[model samples]
Structure formats: C-alpha cells, structure tokens
Target: MAETNKPTATKGVLSIAMIKKLIGAVVGIILGVYIAGIGVPEGLTTKAMWGMAVFICAIVWWIAEVFPDYVTALLMCSAWAVFDIVPFGTAFGGFSNATIWLLIGAFGMAAAVGKCGLLTRISLYLMNLFPLTFKGQTLALMVTGTLMTPLIPSGSAKIAVLAPFAAAVSDSMGYKKKTQGAGGIFAAMFLSLGCIHPLFLSGSFMCYSVVGLLPKDIQSQVTWTSWFINALPWGITVLVLGYLAILFLYKPEEEKRLASTMIKDQRAALGPMSKNEKYVSVVLVLTLLIWMTEVLHGINATIIAIAALAALLGYNVIDRNTFKSGIAWDAIMFIGCIFAVSGVFSALKITGWIGKVLGPHVAPLLAGNIYLFLAVLCIVIYLVRFVLASQLAVITIFTLLLTPLALKEGISPWIMGFTSFVAINVWILMYQNAQYLVAFFGAAGGEMVNHRQMIKLCVAYMIISIIGLLVSIPFWKLTGLIQ
Candidate 1:
C-alpha cells in the first residue's frame, strides 16, 4: 500500500533532469568557449584560458560527484600535450616530482596501517590514555588525527580508518547513536578534525600543487622542517580549543556504564598486526626515508607506490579486486583531467584576464591584514563548497585564478593557498561537502547525525579555524623548510 501510495509527480521527474541538464550545459558552454579560443592565432592556444576551464569543470565534477580526482588532474596534464601548452615532457614532469611521490608513499603507508588495523590499535591505545568518557575518546581521537594529518594526505581514507574506533567509543560509552542528542555530531566533528592533518605538509596534494605555482626562487624556503614549524603548533591550538568547545557543547549523554573494563573488551578483538600491513609499513617507511633524504638518496615515490601496490597484490595481502576497491581510480582520472585543463590556463592567456579581474582589490584584500584575509577566504571557500561540491574544484578555481592577483598585491600566494585548504576542511556545515559524513551512514546502517547538530558544531568550528590558521601560517614562514 505504501509503495502504491507514493507520489508520482511527472513534473518532479522533469525538473530533476532539467536541473542537471541546465547546469551541465552551462559547464559545457564555458568549456566550449574557452576551448574554442585555443584556435584564435593570438588569443587562443595560450594555455591560460582554455586549459583552466577544463581544469575548473573537472574539479567541480570530481567534488560534486563520485568521479575521479587523479584523472582530472592528469587530464590537465594531457591538455598540455594536446594543445602544445608546454613541452609534453615538462607537463608530465609534475607526476614524477618528489612531492607527488611523498603523497603516494604516505597514502600507501596509511593504507597498510588501515588494512592491518594499526591505526585502530594506535587509536584504541590513545583512547586508553584518556578517562574514557565519550568526550575523552573524542578528544583523544581528534588529537590523534591532528598528529597524523601531516603524514597522511588522503582525508577520506583517514576518516574511514578512524571511524571504527569512534564507533567503538560510542558503543563503549553505552550511548546509542542518534538517540543521544548530538552524540554522533561529536563523532562527525572529531572526524573532521582528524581529516585536517595534511595542511602542514608540502607533500599533501593540494599543498604541493599550490606550492608549485610559487615563484621558483621562493620555493626553496618551504621544506618539511619549515612547513611543520607553522602547521604543527597551529594544528595543536585548534585541536585543543576545538576539543573544549565540542566536549562541553556536544556532551555525550551521561552513561551509567564505566570505562574501567572497556579496554579489556577492546583488547579481546585486538590481535597482532597482519602480515600485509607489516609489509606495507616497511615499504612506506623505507619510501619516506628515501623521499625526505632526497639530497643524499633520491627515490621516486610514484614508482615505489605502484610497486608496493603491485607487490601487495602478488603477495596476497590484498587481491586484485580488493586493491581495486581500495583505490579511487576515478579520482586519479579526475586529477588527470584537471591537469589537462590547467594546461589551457597556460595555453590561452586566460590567467592574465583572471589576474586583471582580481587586480584592483588585491592589495587591499591582503594588504598587511593577513589573518583577516585568510579568515575571510576560509569562510568564503567553505560556503562555496555548497555549490561547488569538490575540494579539488575549490583549489583549482580559487588557487589557479586568484593566486596571481593576490601575489600582485604583495600577498604571499603560499598563505593564500594555505587558507584555501583550511577552509576546505571545514566541510561539517553541509552534507554536500564531506565524504566523512557519508561514511558515518555506511558504517552505521543508514543512520546519520542530524544536520542541525552539524550546523551548531560547524559554527563553533569557525573559531577553531582561525586558531588553526594563526598557529600554522607564521610557523611556516618562521621555521621555513617544510616543502
């Protein structure tokens, strides 16, 4: 009867299709105009305009939906070859860069840790450090995340790995999810915080790309030592403050149960790390050592990652299908697309137009008011994710187009780039922006935290963002060697 009673509005059906078509058409038109310009002898093929349009759309698509980010990035690289925007060799150069290898190695290590449940062990071990109040676990988990972020670049994978521990805590506290007001909201917010760790690393994908755009002379100033100087302290400040705000405001329902015995139960299921995980760890550790000591010992990270991924399959740590399940190939494809599109920015002279458009307010926007500028940039980008829907899209659009303009005004593009990431991670306000939100549902049989609760948590997080930015930005400049 309920199935029969379902509304059958033909208009609703029509409207949904229309919305997608309308939006898609606009995207196509924008891409078309830019690509069309590539043919204009003087105006076209300059790589600035056309490459960027594809770059923009691909980023949007990857973020808005479940398409590939890596593929999009690679596509931008491909555009360089197709349009002769840059030497095909130079365009492919980025793929082989040490920073790219760092991403691959770090993620591979994370994957091994996740597969063998090392992260869970670490997570549970950390949980044991606190009083085991639900809040204690939440705070501990968040601290762990902040500690982990500089090392781990894939936010979604990190949160996915962390979710089980959070669930275990929720269960340990004896508070049923959803029935307890905002309990799951604590879960969501903590996950957001944990996912935020990569902001410090020059190796994080967005960080690397943004850093790549900096003037060559300024590049040497950012090394691993310098980036962490700023990021670690700032990340700690935000985590500490965020924990306080969340613990008090989103307090878990007082449980009659005690945690004195919970660790014993958790230990029951905790076994020795699996063999594959150990292999992954070894491979990743060895890889990172090579990457960090590039001056004395240079090893390619991508090759190492690909080799490890292949070796994992051969060794049966993960079978082919399982490996496929683990990697988001679509995202890889999307990254390629973005690379191809970014090529047009160089090909068509579009960047100049974008720069001029943003020129007037450049100085005043960032003129000696760094904190305010970054704060506003974060809030704006965070909100824009509602419509934009992809983290990569936000980076591609804002970083590529607006960066030169901000630089012209004496603003450090690096700082501006950092702000884009700070804003992007605060995706708690809207369901549309975060993969972690979706994971909570899958992990919990379709049950989810309330949107209103998320709103409250995100609102409080606005303050936390400022704290994070303040701690990290100057630290980057001071310590001066994190890239």
Candidate 2:
C-alpha cells in the first residue's frame, strides 16, 4: 500500500529522497566551510579541526542517506588527501591494510559456499533434524543460524542464504504473511544471526572492523580463540534469551505439526554433493582449522584467508566473475575508508582531546565500577543508534572517547569495544539494522513477515542484549578482563 501510494516524480517537483539529498548536501557543505574557517583550538592541530569538519560532513551525509555508504566513504577518504589533512598514502592506506584483505577473502569464501548450494543444503539438513511444529521450526532456524555463523562471516550473506529457506518453511507450514508462525521463524533467524557475531573474529566484518579500531598491541592479543573465549558466555546468554523472547512474543495460534516433506524433499532434491561443494567444504574447513590454530602457527589471520581465496580460485571453485561479484566491494571500500578516517582522527589527536574534555563529566558514573560503567555505556549507545546510522561510527566514536578512561580504571579496552559493538548491533526499528532490512526485503521478499511482528522481536533483542552484557560480568572477571 505504501509503495503504491508513493508520489510519482514530475518536472520541477522533487521526491522525498531527492529532498533529503539536497538538504544533506547543503547542510554538509555549509558546515564543512564554516568549521574550516574557525581557528584551530588550543591543544589541537589545524589539521585536526579540518579533519573534524570533513568527518562531520561525511557523517551527516551518511545519516541522511544521501548516497550509498561506499560513496560517502569515498568522498571522505578523498577529502582527507585533497585537503592535506593526511598524506595521500596515509589517507588511502586502508586499501593495503591486512584487515581489509581478511574481509575480502572471507566474502569470497562465503560466495563459494553460497554458489555451490552448500549453504542451502546445510540449512535444510539442520531444519529437517527437528519436528515440524511451530516451536520446533523456529528453534531449528535459530540453531542453523548460530551454527552457520562460523562458516559464513557476513550476517547479510547468512540471511541471504537462509531467509528464503525460512520463508519456504513458513509457507509449507500453512503460515501466511504477518502470521505468528512466519514472523517467529524470521525473528529467530534474523536475531540469532545478528547476536552471535561477536563470539568469533570471523563472525562479521563489523567484528574485524571494531578490532581494527583498537590499538595495535590490543589487536594482536584478540585472535580467534581469545575472542571466542571472551565472548562465549555473553554470546550464549543472548542467543538463548533471544530465542525465548521470540517464542514468547510470536506465539502460534495452534500447536499442530506441519509437514516435514518439504524440508526432507528439498534435502533429497540436491541428490549428491558436486565437486565444487566438496572442494569448497574442504577449503572452508581447512581455513577454519588454520584460523583456530593461529596461536601455535603464529601466522596472521589475513594471510590464511588470502591463501584460502587463492586455493578457491586456483581450483576453479569460483571463477573470475565470482571473484568480482562474490566479494562485497562496496563494504570493502566503506570499511577501508573508515580505517583511513580513524587513522587521521588518531593522528590529529582528536580522540585524546575528546577524552580530556568529556572524561571529567563521565568519570563519576564510570569511576571504579565496571558494572556501572558498562550499564551507562550500553544505555548511551542505545540512544545513539537512534540517530547514528553507521554502526562503525558509533563504535569508533565511543571507543576513542572511553577506551582511555577504561584503561585508566584497570579495564581492558576490548571489554569497552566489544560491549559497544554488541549494544549498537541490537535494533528495535527496521532502519537501524541494515542486515535485517536485507533479510526482510530480499529473502523474505517483504511479504513473509511484516513490520509489526518484527518490532516485537526487535524490542526483545534490545532488552535481552543489555541483560546478556550485564550477566557476563562474572565471566569477564574470571577471564581477568576486570580487576
């Protein structure tokens, strides 16, 4: 209905999207010029003030949705080098960063898995292991998504692979659009895929990006095994609590069993694994094993991932087209640009100045009490998400401001960084989570589940995420992350 009612474009009349772009453009340019005109403040360099202006403009354009995120990122990166805020190599240095390569390699592996029908086959096998009841189906989806997390690092990629299966399951069960059963299946899949990302370094590019934002010394310590160990308790708590929330909020009208024929039939339809599937499975397993054993081998994670990509290409498991289309180049550009932006921010001493200015005001609430600090931090991040469209922005800003204080209080900066990542990832609105939007509109086809029911799941996630973080304090203590 909303789509049908959208006003058509006409000469001399602008659409809402166009109006947003215009306003964003005008506001961004004006602010950038005005800020640049201001004299550099005490204790901050001239380049830092200009960097702030450019960063602010880019952020405004991003929140306004003026252009694709990658485009905005491109503009920011170009601005830094053009304005001499940083050297050209420094401004564009993220392109050569190891973290960027890791993401590129991960996306390629995901593409191979997705293209070979392995992801779909695995999903069906997982779902078919359970009963055909509504509760059983929803639980199956949650479990499948969790299990798939390690194999597929990108949440959007996972949703792309699983959401269609979820919709098919909903239809097979006689559930219609906006129906409780259908909504439950989607809620379980989307939320479960989202919440478990922090548990593994390869779980999502967001995890890798956040870790990249940390200091170099801290980055070396946060390998795959240590990340899982640190995040296991919190990740498990959120997954269980979130599943319970879905079951509670989207109860089915009846408990009758549905047909399992569709699931079993689909699994059988594949007949046998092709050579590509076998090759992809081998490469994926070997890559994961190498990643997990990084402590002993002492090889960088990026090298292993690049090697996996090479193996896939060498074996012809994925062709040149797959190499081009399979990787999320836009995400790669966006993340790389963000890294450059953050580098400039750090070099300009902007973060230290922010800490100095805001530290005193935030010190009391955050002082000496790790629990209180976390609680307050979570609440602030929750509110910030309402306006900040980019999760990376939220993570970067909060980490810069609060990490110094956290370290001063005998807390690891990883705790602060990881908590902020988790808090910002939980969303109660459609627009807040881009990955969820992709799942809803792409996999679910914007029909299998409706916004009203999904909102209930989102609210549940919001509350449960906070509870999960709070519950993990004891575990963090045991790990010696807190004094």
Candidate 3:
C-alpha cells in the first residue's frame, strides 16, 4: 500500500511544478506585450522599447523561477538578438568578457582546494581550537569563513567548501537540526559569508564589477588596496554585530565539558599534507600577493586569476576533467550574460535614457541633502533585493539607473557605487540567492535552523548595516570621497 502511494505523491508534486511554470510563462508574455506597447519618450531609441520588454520578462521569469537562471539569461540574450534590440554579435558578447575567465579560474582553484582535502583540514583545525562551547565553535566558523574570503572570490564556493565541516561540527557537539544550537552555527556561517564581500576587491565578483560600472575617471582612481581601506571598517563591524546578534537571539543550551575529540580525530586521520595540497597552497598565496600589489605590478586582477589557474593546471593540481566538472558554470554564464547586456545598454545609450527620464524628477529633491539621499537610496536598494534573485543583476541595473542622478546631485559616484554594492547583498531571506539557500540548509540533507529564527537574525544584521553606513558618512567626507 505504501509503495503504491509513492508514485501518486511524486505525480502530485510534478503537476504543481508544471502549473507554476505555465503561469509564469503567461505572465511574462503579458508583461512583455504591455511594456512593448507603451510609447517611447522623446530622445529614446525604438530599441529601448524592445530592451525594456526583454528586461521585464527576464525579471518576471527570474522572480517566478519559471526556468533556471541561466536559461532565463540565455532567453534574454536571444530576445535581444531576435528583436534587433542589439546586433546578434553584441547580444551574446558576454562570452568574451575577461571576468568570466576570472570566475572560471577562481572556481577551478576552489575545486582543487576541496579535492585535496585542504579545506576540511583548515576548517577542522579552526573548530578544534575552540570546541568546548557553542559560542566558541560559532566564532571559529566565522573566522574561518572570513579568512577564506580573500582567497575565494565566490561566496557560494566558500560556503560549499566549509559547509560540510560545519555540519560535522554541529553533529559532533550533539546539536541536532532545528535546535537553537544548530541555528546559531548556521546563522554565524550565513552572516559571516554575507558580510565579508565588502572587505576586499577579491572578496566577491560583485565588488569589482561595481568598480567597472563607474565612470572612467573614477574607475582609474579606485584600486584593490583603496577598496579594502574604504570598506574594511564597515565589514568588520557587521561581522562583530552578526556574532553578537546570533548569541543573543539563539542562546544554545549549555554543554559543560563538551569534547573536542572529534575534530582532533579527524585532523589526525588526515595525517600529513600531500604534494597536491602544498602546490595549491603555494599558488593561492602567490595569487593573493599579486592581487594585493596590483598598483606596483600593474596587472589586471582577471589576468592574475587566469595565470593562477594555468599554474594549477600546469602543476597537475587540477586536470581537465576536474576543472570541467568543478567550476560553477551556471554562475559564470549568468554573470557573463549580464555583462553582455550591460555593454549593449552602453552602446545603445539606454542607460542615458533612464537618467534622462527619471533624473529631473528625482534629482531636485535631494540636491542639498547628501545624507538623507544616501539613506533613502540604500534602503530602497535593500528592499528591492526581495524580488531580485541575482546580486550581480541588481548592481548592474540599478547602478546604471541611479549613478547619473547621484553625480548630478553632487554626490560622488564612488559613494553611490560602493553603497549600492553593499545594499544589494543585504538579504532577509534564503530565497534571495543560492548562497543563502545553502547556508539555510546544512551541507548534509537537512534543514539547519527554523526560518523565523534566521529571519530575525538577518533583520538585526540589516539594522546594524544601516547604522554603520550612517556613521561612516563623516569619515567619508573627511577622506575627500564626498565633497
């Protein structure tokens, strides 16, 4: 009788999924038709109408999860080409962007690090040092994640590398899934990963991509070191606040004399480091050194990443098969497609059209009040992430729309770009991105914590982030970034 019911249940789930997809399709088509039918304003090209239609449809599909994000990205590009919104060559041009190659290399290195057992060794070693209590274990995981940020540009990759060890540590400490202890552990991991992005240019692709969107004069002034200096204080503050918030909201039951033996035993099992580990370590360190000294060396960060990948492949740390299967191709493709579409916007001047339409109406209200403008802008961007799935997409779209207005209102483009990058990352729920989802569910197949608990913790962190931005305004002004 149980066996007979299994197939029926499976069919029920499939039917629901099919219905959702169909509804999403109908909604997307209707939205496209409605927007395309609207008349274009004076000084806007006919192509802008088609571009706007495709953009709306893509957003609808993305929010509805009508298709996988990469598939939606491909469909967007196809629409651009077929409708002559841009030339065929231009629509698919993201494949040639250097950032895509950088992502490939970064992801390849992560795979190599994971395959050689180094990631496990590092995580276990950290947890072992503070294994006596839940708070200590949470701090250890947070520190490990923070340390890995500069080396791993992808937050999802960092989570993928450390999540398994986090699960192991939680289980060994007798903290079962859905308990406060488990909730605290997962919360620490999630918040740390989210907060680390602003600290360094290499921390995430979103950081440098924002820099790329800046005007040429401003872009030339920004460097890896400058970005680190500008954002370090806020990033550290968020991490500290996140740690405290977790402890306050989810107080784990006291476990006196909890054994640290599991981590030690696992560390002992690994024995000594192998040749592959040593080689990957050396390459990672050298790559980081080069990335830090870009001012003196004058090599682009993307090129440095590619060279590191080549060294990994050259030394046999990662072979073709491992490299092919290991990289996050979906993420890379989505980024590339977004970048390509951005280029099309630049070429056709659609971004300029956006500024022309919205700038006059909004710029006058905030002309003399920089602080109020910054606060309102940041909050609006933060709230907008609820409907958007991709951080990169948010940064690309809103930055294009708002940067001109920011400049016209006497605010520095640098401040506008930096604040937008940070705001888009402030998510209150797991459905916002894949990294959030991974951290919400443990590496092993079970829910790590209750949804309400996670939401409360995220809300606290967002409040802290906003306060941090408000306090930093004077410092930014003194530093000549906002005159």
Candidate 4:
C-alpha cells in the first residue's frame, strides 16, 4: 500500500466533514446498487442507499470505536431522517415508544438500587449465605442472580450486580482468582442473560413485551405463564450447567483472598444492615411483585419502580445526584436508538425480505420435523452469536426475523420462542458475548482468543447444549413441562 501526506480531496463545496459525508453517500449509492444487482432488496435505489448507509456507518462506528455505541445509533437514526430514508416522523416517532419508556424506567430503578447500596447489600447477603464449600457458594450465587435478572433486564445491570460482588468474594476468600477467571466471568455472564428465568413468567419483560406487540393470536400463544414455563427450566438448567462446567474446569492456582480479604479486620466499619437498606429492600420486593402481576395489578413495574425512587427521594435516602449517578445512560440511548432504527427495518420490512430468502432453504429441513428444525435453529442462533457481539442485538434481530418464519414453517411458535431464548445465552466462547468476557478481562470486552480457538470452544458448547436440550425436550413435551 502507498501512503500520502497531502490532504485528500474534499467535497465539491470544500470541507473535511462534507467530504466524509459525500464519501458516505457515494459508498451507500455503490453498495445499494450492488445489493440491488445481487437481490437483497429490490428497486427503490434511494431508500436502499439510505438504509444501507445507516447500516454501514453504524458498523464502522463500532469497529473504529470512534464514539459510544449509542452515539453511533443516534447518528444512524439522524442519517436516515436527513437522507429521507423514511418519513421524518416515522423515523423519529419510535423514540416515544412505551417499550422504550419501560427500558428507561428500568435503568432508573437499577440506578436507584445501586445508589442505595442495595445491590452490594443484596449481593453480599447472597454471597455470605450457604456453607463454605465451593459447590455450595456457587449454587447460592446462581440462585441470587437467577432471581435478580428479570427485574433488571439489562445485561449491564447483571454485570453491575455480580462483578464487584464476585471480586469482593474472591478477595474475602483470599483466592487470587487467576486460574478461575473463567469461573468469575461465567458467574457474571449468567447474571446478564438469565433474566428469562421462571421467576417472572414465560418470558422476560423485554422478550414478552416485544413479542406481545405482535398480533393477538401470536401474542396469546406467548403469554407470561406459557413463556416462563417453557423457558425457565432450560434457563435455570443452562446457568447451573455452565457454572458447574467452569468450576470443574478450573480452580485458582493458589488461594489469595480466601479467609483473609474480608472486612473482618475492621470491626467498627462492619455493621448490620441499616434502615435505608431495609427500606430499599421493601421497595425492591414490592416493585418485583407489582411487575410480576402487571395484568392483575393494572400498574406496570416501571411506575412502581419510579414510585420507589420518588419515595426514596421524598425521604432524602438518595438525593437527585446520587440517583442520577445510579443510572446507566449508555444503556438507555444504545437500546433506544437500536429500537428506533428497528422502525426503519420495520418500515422497509427488511427482516421480511430476509425471511423470504431463507424460507425456501429452511422449510424443507424444518418440515414435519420439529426436532431437526429446533436443533438447527438453535445452532444457527448459537453460531449467530459469533457474528453479533451483543446478546440484546442477537435477541432483537433473531427473534424479529426468525419467530415469524418459524411460525410460518408450521413449527410451534412457542417452541421457536423457547429455542431463541436458549440460543441467546448458551454461547460459551470468550468473544461471542462481551458480558462473558468482561469479568475475565475486567472490562466490557478487552481481550480476545484466536478465531480458531473461539470457534472450536463455541462449537463444543453448541454441540453439548444442543444434545442436552434434545434429550430433555422429549420430557418437556411429554409432561407438558415447559411453557
């Protein structure tokens, strides 16, 4: 490759940013034309160009790490609107979606919980329980996380809930935690993805709410009871299985934190739970109860969560700044932007088009063969984890497109829903999900294993989990064990 020192050509109007935008436009035009030639989306060159442009830019922003993911998302939305990809209102209107509000409100509740030291207190209480054996301690942690995930749907929330606590446990036990980094990572990963557990219902708030937005017939088959029943067994099974797998696979080289890293030294600092902690605990339980019985209570979990915050604020337990500090705004914007752009995908029915393409190839394999279809779909969704880095992204895109196709293929919608749920969390390779790697690496994602090793590990995980699911599925069907 050759290098140049002089400035590159600018736009005809002559400005650096204008030149980049022109380049983006030109690249979009070329790619759109090529896609039209190859048959992904047909006709309407203008719309295709704009859609592909936002898509391209979004990917580039992530690869470049030029800005936060949410920034990239908002820019994608702006690009679509500015380029007239869809009606301006259509592009921006989804920002006001009730789905988005629930996510935002959930973020607020997570923040409030954190500021009140409720998560630490809760996590410590969980960690400190059970016998001193590794088996007992691990089981306790798994139970604590399983119960917590649905209420805090964000994977990041799980990380916040578990990472520090895990680190603290490692410290308290005097275990150096080097060899068992994978175990630590695995424990945290469960917190991130285990929200679909049976505690709430047939589905997670996000999954159910997204699915609920479907037509009533589809919605009826995927109620809370049904989804929770179908999913929780596998969800709980996978988490426990994965946890035990890590424990059996590795142990710390030497105990660094065991029996030495506790607050046992500082008698004055170590005290019992205070009144504020009790108050937040009550608020959390009430919020969860209200959330689970949304239909009967006629009030959403979000309002209850917000009310809890207001109550905290009223009593000056957590002032505005503390509360504000608790919120993870990146999650809100990132999820919201992705949801809004999903409107464009909805507007263009892009997933529908992809469905048309895959339908023929997939139908024969799935026809009259629920086992083959379910197994293949799970692997495909699992392999898809390699391509998509974020669990939420995988769930959103996969469920949006695959659920409808699965239904159309004569596979039970409920079965497909369960398969999709399993796929999102079953990824075992280090790189496939950031939440898995974050604890191991000490950030969201800062490390990598070679592609070959990653693929092999993922394949092993995919094969094992699929086999387990297959053996268990018959039982699930016979006893009507799952939702």
**What is the per-residue lDDT of model 1 for residues 1-483, given as tens digits with 9 covering 90 to 100?**
666545556667867866775676477557646664655444444454444454555545444432333444565567657876567765665444443333333334444455666655665676678766565566566666666555545444444445544555555556666644335434544544444554466335567766676667657777766566556665666666766776666765664435666666776678676676577667656654544443344444456555665665667666555556544334333333323333334345554444444445443566556667677767676666553434655666566655666667655566666666666665452333444443443233224354455555566666687768766666655554222
lDDT of 4 by residue, 138-205 (tens): 66666666666655444443443354455544444444434353344344344434423423452254
Q: Supply candidate 1's per-residue lDDT for 18.
A: 69
In order of appearance, the predictions have TM-scores of: 0.59, 0.71, 0.75, 0.69
Q: Which stretches of candidate 2 lie over 4 Å from their true place?
A: 1-14, 37-39, 131-138, 144-194, 197-236, 245-258, 367-372, 381-462, 471-483
Model 1 RMSD, rounded to 1 decimal:
7.5
Give one digit per residue, the lDDT tens place, for model 3 in 1-483. Answer: 999999999999999998998898889989988887888778767787777778778877876778976789899989999988899888888788775676566667667777787877766766668756888988988887787777656665456545555766676677877778878877777777766677788788677789899889889989878888777667767888878888888787765346566667877999999999888888877876776555566787678778888998898788878887666566666666766766676666765565465446545655767767767767776666654445676677667666776777556677777777777765464445555544443244335566667777767877777766776787777777776
- Cα displacement (Å) at residue 213, model 3: 9.5
Q: Least accurate stretch of 10 residues (summed lDDT) in model 4?
A: 442-451
TM-score of decoy 4: 0.69
Residue 391 error, candidate 2, Å: 8.8
Cα lDDT, model 3, residue 343: 69
What does candidate 3 score in Cα RMSD to the true structure?
Answer: 5.3
Q: How much does each candidate deviate from the true structure in C-alpha RMSD?
A: 7.5, 6.2, 5.3, 7.9
lDDT of 2 by residue, 1-483 (tens): 666555544422666668989999889988987887888877798888888888778867876778976798799889999989988887887687776777667667777777788877766676568877878888888887787787555566456546666776676677877888788888887877766778787788778888888789889888889999888888888888887888888888766574577777777888899999999999988877776555567777688778998999999888999888666666567767766755676677775565465556665676756677777878777876654545776787777677777778777889888988988875564446666655665444467887777877776777777787788889888888877
